[model samples]
Target: MKTLYIDCFCGAAGDMLLGALIEAGADYEAISKALNSLGVDGYTLSCEKVNKHGTMATKFDVHVDDAHDHPHRHLRHIVEIIEAGDLPKEVKEASLETFRRIAECEAEVHGTTIERVHFHEVGAVDSIVDIVGVHLALHQLQPERIVSSALHVGSGTVKCAHGVMPVPAPATVLLLRGVPSYSGDVDGELVTPTGAALVAQVADEFGPMPHMRINTVGVGSGTKDLPDRPNVLRVMWGDAVGDFHTKESITVIEANIDDMNPELLPPLLEDLLESGARDAFITPILGKKGRPAHLITVLADDKKVSAVTDTLLRGSSTLGVRMRKEQRICLERDWKHVLTPWGDVRVKIGTYKGTTSTTSPEYEDCARVAREGGVTTREVYESAYAAAIKGEYKDA
Candidate 1:
């Protein structure tokens, strides 16, 4: 599968992300034409090669006309502008999702509804271009998966419409919920609201760069002079090396509880999955004193370990939890919808080297159909499985 990895060594911003995509071989004219097609005027997009410290990188800039100075805009207005624009369906959806994330954060920070929240910096014409153009560039790349490293949010304070605020700004910090990030050595605002929203929207997994065969690398330089490190973001285009299905990492967290209520274990498992655990379950075991106990195990990616671990600790009576990192192999898989006698059921198809290896019905869909049809879930599963095996399932 084709994959794109973002390396935020210094930090990221809207312009910086676009620059990286351009450096990674995105068509600049096509992106500009897309922005123009939006029917929003008074801005020009420009790119040039520049030196950041000793490394050469591309610098992206948006020059907006003074005549189009509208500093504040409501979330609904921004949504309407995007919906009316002439853009690819995928581009429009991705752009709208990013903007929605920003609005949600702003609303939470200001204690207001999303519609009532007023956007200052992010609602500007230049920011609109950056966010929409970034999605357009991503659509051109056609990556099957996108991964990113832990973000390096800078230190110190930044002045915004809300006056002087701590580094990572209020909106930025809120958007970074569940994202892995840390303050860098630099003393300034590194991750902007636009950058935070973009990354939070696009990135599928976050941690160290995964193992892949490098095809190309792009360096996007931010327009800032820092005392500690070069202000730049690196993007890499590549494919998985060796057996693509064999390389993956997951953290296994386990805790043995003897005092927790047995009835609460089910809800704890649900909480763990809701908190981003890949999987969670409990196994009956015996404690040291020969008492019956439960062993809670949670499987999660490295980025979600903290959140999942917290859930495990808070929901269980265990004093300590053990953790071990393990590698897992998975088959390439996708979903399909099968038309059953009663309704459409979702099926999971696993493939290996262009051949189907396994076919199974989605349990949630089967359960729902069974409840409505007054039948057993097993019957629904068998029907869907047969349909999938006979190549009778249609793509949803």
Candidate 2:
């Protein structure tokens, strides 16, 4: 399948992402036209070929000629600006979604609602164009998967709307919670909040570049030309050598606790699941003291072991937990939208050797429907599952 691999060696920004796409064979003229269609004037895009550390790259510059920097904007104002734009429906929707993700990240960091969140640099005209432009370019590519290298958030401090702050900025840090990142010798805000939001929203996997036939390469130059490092973002597009297969070992943890309050089990299980446990549950057990206990079990990948274990220890009254590496054979999974009485639920269909094996609705989606429809989560899940099965048969 066709795929795009983003080499974030120098870190990524909204403009850098767009520049990389343009370098990777995206039509500059077409993209410019699309940006203009948004009806936001006072900004211009300049594209050029430049060399970074002896490597040739495309550099896209979004120039704003205002005498003073644009002030921060509220989430509603930003949304209104996007809604007023004359871009295509898909482009508009994608851009809005990216902005929404940014707002949500900011809200979480500042402990405020999304509507009350204000964007600083991200609300500027140039940044908005960069974000919306990147979305449009990505939609044009439509690759099967998008992957990125671990982000390099530079060291030291940077200025923001909130005054001088440490490198990575609070909002950017919040946006990159689950993504792999690190700080290096470089000293600056390498990854901006807008950049982090975009990557976190779209990146399917975070690791080394996968095995693919290199078709195109693009390099986006950053504003600062660091003396020691090439300030650029690399985008590579190609086809993988073999059928995509992910191979990794996982750990299964189990512990029996007899003294925990039964009422706390539900919240504890929720915490574990949210903390990256693949699965968590409790089973009734008769303890050695002849007292009743609940057997807590968790399945998680190695990277999540600590958080999973911490959740168990902090949320439950378990004295000790046992963990062991277990061999797990998992089929390839894909998502499909299934229409149910409550709403549309995303169903995950698992296939082994090209044959369907298992199907389930996403828990969050089912739970939302359950709350809305005043029914058990199982009821919503079963309804969605049945609908998916019917749809699969119809397709067959």
Top model number, TM-score: 1
Model 1 residue-pair collision total: 0
For residues 84-161, write the lDDT of model 2, one tens digit per residue. Answer: 876765566567777887888888878999998888778888888888888778878866668889999899999877
Candidate 2 structure lDDT: 0.81
RMSD of each: 10.6, 11.1
Displacement of residue 305 (Cα, Å) in model 2 is 26
Residue range 148-201, candidate 1, lDDT tens digits: 888899999999988999998998999999889999678899899999989877
Kindly give the stretch of ten consecutive residues in candidate 1 with the minimal lDDT sum: 239-248
